[model samples]
Target: MVTATALEAELLELAGAVPDPELPVLTLRELGVLRAVHVQGTDTVDVDLTPTYTGCPAIEAMSLDIERVLRSHGMREVTVRTVLAPAWSTDDITPEGRRKLREFGIAPPRVRDGSDPVPLSLGPTRTIATHAAADPDPVHCPHCGSADTELLSRFSSTACKALRRCLACREPFDHFKEL
Candidate 1:
């Protein structure tokens, strides 16, 4: 495995600290977007970032924020590159990020494993344990912690999320869809 120099590490931390434009509650690091930071020369650095998904409009904002941060921290030239290889996954979200998402009234995407059963959300309280790799896990309401929720819309405020209403709490919220 490659190791980062102290300066690179520091720069990485700074770049990762920038907040996501869409989900302001989580940092880029927490969202697992800031991939790496490499110091090219004395005053130049290159940063690799993966968006939450392809064609994410927020990538430009994230890049600007990262560049501004690194430039202010003594780097003369900062290059933020969008990396598509090893596409970003919901599984990349840190545990803390998931917690923050829940706290912010968004249902975090359920973690997935290849061995796990196919999750199919039949309804707010219905489930079908089939062999299909669908989202079978119930999107619990973050406010009331109730599994009784209904999808109001396939897309929420963002394309990456779904709008849901909790039957128990009668509150509407967004669910970060699994990617």
Candidate 2:
């Protein structure tokens, strides 16, 4: 028989399997939203989550996904609690999560150094610049690896991303804006 701790671990693993509704390529873990998992009893599991953004519609679906995954694992009495304090940021993204985002064709958040120039190379340049909304970076095209990407629209399919087109590849794709 699995101990309560073991059951909690299993539930966490299952929760990690549930992808963010907004970013299908990213799991709740990748988004740093799955805060904690606790086993209330032999049959009950509790999960704590933080939303990526306020008023994000994905939270509803995320809650449903958590409940569904736990139920599928035979944990019928499951509760998902959401916390709002200490707002979420791209800095909360784990290294593995960043790697996943890169593989998914969305550049991870740029770490700024207050005055460092924006990295212009796709092959690892070491400089940072503030990614303020008023001073957006020259986002590279994820598909063709071109620094010659231009913002097609400030809004994409989701609020977290922007639509961009690669001048070299001539491909339109979504760029995860720095926030």
Candidate 3:
């Protein structure tokens, strides 16, 4: 007995509850991926979401999660749409999302000065010896809040993150790599 307006509102609320599959701390809205929500009649809800990265494996899981959440609320014929025009960036992450990420044991993306060098390296000579210096800005440890961290692996449980350990806290955490 729900009106179209009420159904749309309910669907949005359910969508808001569905977190990003890869980054559980961020919801689709917080990630700036939930572009549009439309109520196609009474039983159908259309959701527009942009993928964080091209060919991201999490997209499938996220779409499924959205559908599941909507269906639980008695929404039938839920349609999850993917859009990729503008693309996603760390800047798209809201302040609240950043706070959540930090609390969830992942350091938020740090703003970098353009003067840090294009390759973030001196030259080919240094690049051959050490790839470490090539990183423009050092990633801070999420646990200890220290800059003294080392990259353990380029890819974590998810492809979008890198595994790092805090030298001070001796704790391992994920770092959202700069794309």
Whole-model lDDT per candidate = 0.88, 0.75, 0.74
Q: What is the lDDT ranking, best to worst? A: 1, 2, 3
* Per-residue lDDT over 1-179 for candidate 1, one digit per residue giving the tens place of the 0 to 100 score: 88999999999999989999999999999999999999998999999999888999999999999999999999999999999988888888999999999999999998888634434454543223222234366788999888877778778899999888887778989999888
Ranking by TM-score: 1, 2, 3
lDDT of 2 at 38: 88
- Deviating ranges (above 4 Å) for candidate 1: 115-136
lDDT (Cα, tens digit) per residue for candidate 2, span 1-179:
44447777888989987988877788898888887788886778889888877888889899999999899888878899888776676666778777777778876665555643444434322233223353554566667666766666666888877677766778877776665
Q: Candidate 2: give the clashing pairs.
A: none
User: How far off is residue 14 in model 1, in Å?
Assistant: 0.5
Q: Is candidate 1 or candidate 2 better by TM-score?
A: 1
Q: How does each model score on TM-score?
A: 0.88, 0.75, 0.75
lDDT score, candidate 1: 0.88
lDDT of 3 by residue, 92-160 (tens): 677888788888999777655453422322333211111236555677777878777776776788777
Which residue runs does candidate 3 get wrong by more than 4 Å?
A: 1-10, 112-137
TM-score of 1: 0.88
| Model 2 lDDT-worst window of ten | 123-132
